[model samples]
Target: MKLIKYCLILALFSPLAARAQQPAAPAAQAPIVLRPGDMQVQARSAANRPDRAPVYPGGEQALGLFFLEHIKYPEAARVKQLSGMVVVTATVNVDGSVSNPQVTQSLSPECDAEARRVVSLLTGWQPAMRRSRPLAVLIQLPVPFGTAGHMTVDQARRQPQR
Candidate 1:
């Protein structure tokens, strides 16, 4: 008799419990469009120039400060006094994530690794916009040394990777 009563109670609440457990609707995915010369331009810059360049979350000044705070001159480099620019090539994705960091220019192996490490820490950029749509762009960043030598992200963004 008690089992029958419990079964009746469970049955009454099961629909409500099931409804609560249902997953929310997924977001719609955007369609990708490709035109001729797309890869060539993106291979060069945006696939083409952007309507608006990607902004580091706060701004360029903030980015400089980020580099200053995050980048560490490697101990070996410091000991050897090997100071020069470390050019890191990275993509600021449409999702505002930094990806594919590469050391296009090397100062020292230690410095290159350190520069890559620092660049990888950066995220949450205002993605590049083209025709009012978000797009990814390849960017070169120069992290300099000796305290007064580093270029700002704006300067770095405009620079071509070598």
Candidate 2:
């Protein structure tokens, strides 16, 4: 009877002891491979004469002014007399189409959204060129917004000190 009891106890604890002694499994390794050649890398350039001219060279300035006149601050945004500057970076394709419009700086979420919306509506730009052929080129535009009394730094500087 004693021998049988001892054997039963040993069997019950043996599995638990074995589990505690086992080493953890090693983590799986990710596969690695070399990439093939022939991948083309695209380079972005600014719009310049002889290569390409701004579709709306002076028009970008006009668009900035248009926003100042048109966009009204949203009440829900708690932005009273909202004012900030927007820097739009875009690639003008060879065919004079604007692509990859990016906002480099943002003053407020609403202002940022509005800037993007306005830029998207712009069309009929002169495409940039590489070697006299139309190619994608990057351009940047800075836009300012504000209400009366909230002047831009430049505007403030130009004002006579009181």
Best by TM-score: 1
Clashes found in each candidate (C-alpha, N, C closer than 3 A): 2, 3
Best by the lDDT measure: 1
Candidate 2 positional error at 2, Å: 99
103, model 1: CA deviation in Å? 1.1
Which segments of model 2 are wrong by more than 4 Å? 1-50, 57-61, 65-72, 76-78, 147-162
Each candidate structure's TM-score, on Cα atoms with residue i matched to residue i, is: 0.61, 0.50
Cα lDDT over the full model 2:
0.65
* Alpha carbon deviation, residue 79, candidate 2 (Å): 3.2
**Per-residue CA lDDT of candidate 1, range 33-134, in tens?**
787766433434534689788889778778888988887778898898886788999999999999889999898899999989989888999999987899
lDDT of 1 at 89: 95
Worst 10 residues of 1 by lDDT: 39-48
